[model samples]
Target chain A: MNGHVYIIGLGPGDQNLLTLEVLSLLPTLTDIVGYGPYVERVEVPNTVRKHGTDNRQELDRAHHALTLAQQGHRVGVVSSGDAGVFAMASAVFEAIDQGDISLKTIQVTVLPGISAMFAAAARLGAPLGHDFCAISLSDNLKPWELILHRLKLAAQADFVIALYNAVSKARPWQLDTAFDLLRKELPTDIPVAFCRAISRKDEHIELTTLKNAKSSMGDMQTLVIIGSRYSRVIQPLSDCNPWFYTPRSITKK
Target chain B: MNGHVYIIGLGPGDQNLLTLEVLSLLPTLTDIVGYGPYVERVEVPNTVRKHGTDNRQELDRAHHALTLAQQGHRVGVVSSGDAGVFAMASAVFEAIDQGDISLKTIQVTVLPGISAMFAAAARLGAPLGHDFCAISLSDNLKPWELILHRLKLAAQADFVIALYNAVSKARPWQLDTAFDLLRKELPTDIPVAFCRAISRKDEHIELTTLKNAKSSMGDMQTLVIIGSRYSRVIQPLSDCNPWFYTPRSITKK
Candidate 1:
């Protein structure tokens, strides 16, 4: 028997941002698997069995999804935001490459969603309007040295930098260290934004200068966007929120 | 009369990728303004007037949308991908900042959508599984020299690079020049993908090594993804399409 797996991104917290491609597949899913919160976010029919796992058990959950699919069941592996960016799609592929699962009997399709960076950018006004890079500040998967190196180089290149997982319980001090490292290469006046729970009721966007950035401003759910030298702020008029944007311009052609 | 303008991202070329947030706003909009193709993609009631403008007239289109809103029409200015990423959102803000318009006269809200990079990455396994950056190769708005400098620095940072507007008539040689500069630092075998018209009926994806990359493989509509040193390929078993991905890992801690 042959089965299939659909890796779907749920976007941020808002169901309104869910891709029609992913939404269309939900009713047909026999099984749904993901981190507990992400799996709960999907509103599927009663027929689908949901498997929620811990945040760190990606490999195990991927193997489980493949096993279910191999039993001729259609499964959906869910992730908040786009599954391909630091999410479940890679976890499934990594399992196959590591020999933890076999791809001979199962089909896989990955669907994209509205990522947090783009979501936050929309609310904050185009801080990533120019060339930009996104980096995970988590040291669990990579060395802190590498994170520091990339931050310095990104600052040097003047790429608008989006820092994901900027701070977590396991690595509370990393965000501070990163800000310190970035300060060496970037001007103190560069704009930095901390956006949390975007598109949700509790959503908050805070804009401050790099000189005024604080580690406490961000949590696991927060996405920190640091601007390049070219970035600017549009002061709020009366009731409007202040806008941060990088203008479309260049020094020479 | 008070009026509002919503700057929305339609998400790539597919109707399926359009956000429900943007979709839900359609019926409420009295006018829709964007590039011809993007404007055509919106499914609005007959009561809504659609204004399709030339590709180069983003600023004019934005100004029109704002003006229409100021006339008490609920207007939508649409972009193909996330509006904040190289799209109409920034142009609208630029207009506001340049004294071409006054924010006090109209309201603007930007709703995020799935970006092409995230969409392409989902289909290509997880090339952006780790840290990544997106840069537009078009030199019309920015200097060519700056593009080269950023590409070199992105290579040094080992970011999985997503190149947008890789090739256009106005700057046919930019893509080739960019590949040459990246080749100097990246290995010859680094994976590069050309994903064209993704999510549309004629969608095509091709993977090749950086050494084997050709400018002819891409056009204005194609997205070129360059894998970092950590990116890898998963060959198919039997007849399945090959998958490209990057594992979430690092060398040193």
Candidate 2:
């Protein structure tokens, strides 16, 4: 039995954002595994064994999927947002590198999905239309100092910055500190957007300036988009909220 | 007649990579507009009017889309990857900002699609699993110095870098300069991936160390992914090329 493992992203929130490639592959799996919420997002027949665990269990889930696949199961691993963007695709690769020897040869195919940054950016009116960087604000993976260093340098480079995992109950103070740092480093009042639960029924979008942006506006589901110096905002008279975007062409400094 | 405009992405090259939302939106467009190749990619009914143009006329296309929408047409503007990332979303927003007052109030919706970087990274096994930055090498919009400045800062921050619009016949030497710049700044050898025409019939993925990367391996359709210090290569023995990824956690400095 030549077992195979497929890693796929479930997109931000809406099922509509899932790619046809991933959607087509769902029925061919014999087993599926992921974080509880992401696994719940997919619909498969009962014949396919479902394995869902709590958050912060990436390595464990990856190992489980690989082990199952090695045992002649066609396993599918799911992740939120794009699988390669700060998600489970790496965990599976890391498992292949450091796990049991036999698990290394499992055939793995990764399928891309809509990432949170792009999903939120689309709703916010193309705020990341220019050069950009995505930095996760969660300090669980990296040092806070490094995050600050990147924030400063990214601002200096004038790239539209997308902040993932910006705020959560455990780390309420971090995003606030990030805002304070940007205000001091930026010369102009850049446009800022707090996008929460995008594409979901409870979706909330707030537009503010960097000087007035508050960390309280966000939560774990929030993805913050901060525009560069050249970014601008437009208030169309169509009763909708103001839209923000970074222009493609930048004039001289 | 209230005119509505929608800006959507066609994904990398395959129609299967398109999100369900974008696929569903195509048939509803009364008129569709895009670069010639992208416009041809959409399968629309004969009743739908198609507007195809050359490459460098982003401003003109945006104006035309807005004008069509104002005449009570449901117009769709198609871009190659994610509409918001170095694509037509920002151009449409720019047109609204600088165009006629009537165009500003025209209702427009931007839909996100699978971007080239994520598509290429998925094919290459999660090269962007850690903190990452995307920089465009094209100097048509911004100055060359600004691109170099961001490259230096991004590498200094140890970001997994995704270089878009990496090469073209017009600028043959810029990608080579980027490799040289990274080599000078990096302390050790790093894995670099040259992913060209990802998901197309001519798709090519080449994995090489930073020191061994050559400019000739890419074209305008290529997206170069440079792994950070935390990124690693996994040689899963499945008759496949080496897989690359950046682990989620960064151990202490």
Cα displacement (Å) at residue B121, model 1: 1.2
Query: Which regions of candidate 2 fall more than 4 Å away from where they truly are?
Result: none
Give the docking tier of candidate 1: medium
- What is the model-wide C-alpha lDDT for candidate 2? 0.90
**Pairs of residues clashing in candidate 2:** none
Q: What tens-digit string does per-residue lDDT give for candidate 2 at A1-253?
A: 6699999988988989989999899989998899887788788887877899999888999999998888898899998889898789999999888977777778999999999999999988989888899999989888899999989988888889999889989989999999999988885489999999899899999999998899998888899999998999999989877889999997667
lDDT tens readout by residue for model 1, A9-47: 899889988878888989999999999988988898889
Predictions' DockQ, in order: 0.76, 0.86
| Residue B213 Cα positional deviation in candidate 2, in Å, after optimal superposition | 1.3
Candidate 2 C-alpha error for residue B96, in Å: 0.4
lDDT of 1 by residue, B1-253 (tens): 7588898988888888887887788889989999998888888889999999998887788788878877888989999888888888888887777754355457788998888888888888889999999998887788887888899999999999999999898778888889998899999798999999888898999999999998899888899999999889988563677889998887772
- The stretch of ten residues in a row with the least summed lDDT in candidate 2 chain A is A97-106
